[model samples]
Target: MLTLAISLLVAGAVSGILAGLFGIGGGAILVPVLVQALAIMEIDESIRMHLAIATSLGIVVPTSIRSFLAHRKHGAVDMALLKSWAFVLPLGAIFASAVAAVISGASLKWIFTGIATVVGIKMLLNRPGWIVASDLPAQPARSAYGLLIGFFSTLMGVGGGIMNNTFMMLHNQPIKRAVATSSGVGVLISIPAVIGLIVAGWQRPELPPLSLGYVNMMAVALIMPISILAAPVGARIAHAAPKRALEISFGIFLLVVAAQFGWTLLN
Candidate 1:
């Protein structure tokens, strides 16, 4: 128990920093780490991925809020974009979480692994000159894009930042604004994703102790406060760090995490 608490704290700290730094909602880091930690703690394999994803989303709620507030204070966030995405994003996230509940844990793991790899590679190869358009897509196209972001993000246990950042950058939005807006998307998706996970996994017999559906309450309790406190610090760092360096570093980290999950799946 003592070791578990310590591990959760360490993971939370890293996740919090990454949440603010990358606007990834920390799930990109938290999910795989939690899966390993929970497995070591003898959590049931059948529900480990689900529990990790749900609890990761729970942590994202507070972390993303802090990151968003920090970015908003800097006037980096785009309220218009947030407003446009608000409804559809959560709707998609909820639907994805519901779909995830019926899928096997191994399948979810593979999904996360695949998406993370793709996103990581994109980030690594991305150049500042890259542009698909000078502005975001309009109306139905925007809505479709937003839905895809929400669905895939929730499915992979991310906060939607990876996709949102890439999309915005492709549309010629500044990286800082993209990061800030992605933070808001994280908060929007997390709320519904968490609730959806709870509802989807309600009354499941295979869940670990102290779990509320797929979410492990103990993990949330141990990790949430630490992550929340650390997020602002990361947000500050994001502003200070060189944009390209940060993107490359984060991309490498994602690839490493994907490799870890892939290895686990193979074994």
Candidate 2:
């Protein structure tokens, strides 16, 4: 028990730091790591992926709070934009959750694997250069963008950081504000996604220990606070780091994680 606690603590801390630095859910890092680590601990495979994704999301809630607060303190967020897009965020989550229920576990794996690979490849190519500032659309269009972001995010367990940030940056929203706003999206997306997981997995066959539906409460308990505590440190680093270097390095990080996930799926 002590060993498990310590392992989760380390994972949470690393995830939280990355979450803060990137203004994204650390799931891209946490999910694969937790999945493998949990397996090493002899966690059953029946619900392995579910636990990994759910616990990663659970950890993200607290981690995001810490990062969001830190970013808020810096006046990095665009509160007005958040207000405008907030409605679409939850709606998208609901849609995604509904979609998840219909898909089989095997199908979900393929979906996740595909998304991870595509997004990773996109990050590597550095394609989709900055969206034209002058082309920044009206309010309705921005809301549409939010809905799209939320949809993809709910399916993948990410906090919609890449989508939202990319959209905002294209429209001339400063990078700081874009990152800050993306943090807000995490809360919105997680609530519905978590609820959906519960609904989908309730009473299903074979779940591991300390699970709430698909979520592993033990993992959540162990990971949340550590992530929260480490986020401030990451936020400070993000604030100080050169933007281009940070983007490239993190892009590489995403690539590595994607490869890891693919390998897991294959093996």
Candidate 3:
């Protein structure tokens, strides 16, 4: 217990920094770390990923809000767009929770690994020319995009930031603004995702101590405060930093993580 707490503390600090730096909710760092930690705790492999994912979302609630406010003060967030997404994003997260209640843990792992691979590759490519659409489309269409963001993000245990960043950047949104906007997306997904996950995993057997469904409250308690505190530092750095190096670094990290997951799947 002591060792797990310490590990979670370190991960919280790192995740806080990354969240602020990259406009993420720190799920990229937290999810894998939690999975490994849970392994040490001898959690059942069948629900370990689900538990990690749910806990990550629970921890994200405050960090996402903190990051969003940090970016907002810089005037980088697209508020109008976030307002448009407000209703649908949570709806999607809720829907994903329902879906998760039925999916196998290994299936969830594959989905997360696949997404990490694509996102990692995209980051490494760093192509400014990869525009999928000329602009963010009108509503209903926009709502469709929000649904996807919430859906996949919830399933994968990420803040919707990554997908939001990719989608916006593809639509010609500037990287900084995209990052800021994605932070807001993070806020939208966090609470609902946590709730949905909890409901999905309610009364499951074999969860670790202090678990509320798939979400581990102990991990949340340990990770959240530090992550929240460190987020502002990251947000401050993000507005001024050269992103190419950061992108490459994060890309490599994701790909490495993906490779690990792939190996697990194969074995």
97 Cα displacement, candidate 2 (Å)? 1.9
Cα-based RMSD of the predictions, in order? Answer: 1.3, 2.6, 1.2
Per-residue lDDT tens digits for candidate 3, residues 1-267, read 788888899889888877788778889889999999989989999999999999999988899999999999999999999999999999999999999889988888899899999999999997888887888889789999999999999999998888998999999888888989888899999889999888888988888889999999989998999999999988988987777888899889899999998999899
Worst 10 residues of 1 by lDDT: 241-250
**Candidate 1 accuracy as lDDT:** 0.88
lDDT of candidate 2 over 127-241, digit per residue (tens): 3455576555777877888888878776776677767777777777767677777788787777777887777667766777677877778778878877888888888887887
lDDT (Cα, tens digit) per residue for candidate 1, span 64-119: 99999988898999899989988999999999998988999999999999999998
> Of the candidates shown, which would achieve the greatest TM-score relative to the real structure?
3
Report lDDT per candidate: 0.88, 0.74, 0.90
Collision count of model 3: 1
Q: Which runs of model 2 end up more than 4 angstroms from their true locations?
A: 1-7, 41-46, 122-129, 133-135, 264-267
Q: What is candidate 3's TM-score against the reference?
A: 0.97
TM-score to native of every candidate shown: 0.96, 0.87, 0.97
Error of 1 at 65 (Å): 1.0
Model 1 misses residue 239 by how many Å? 2.1
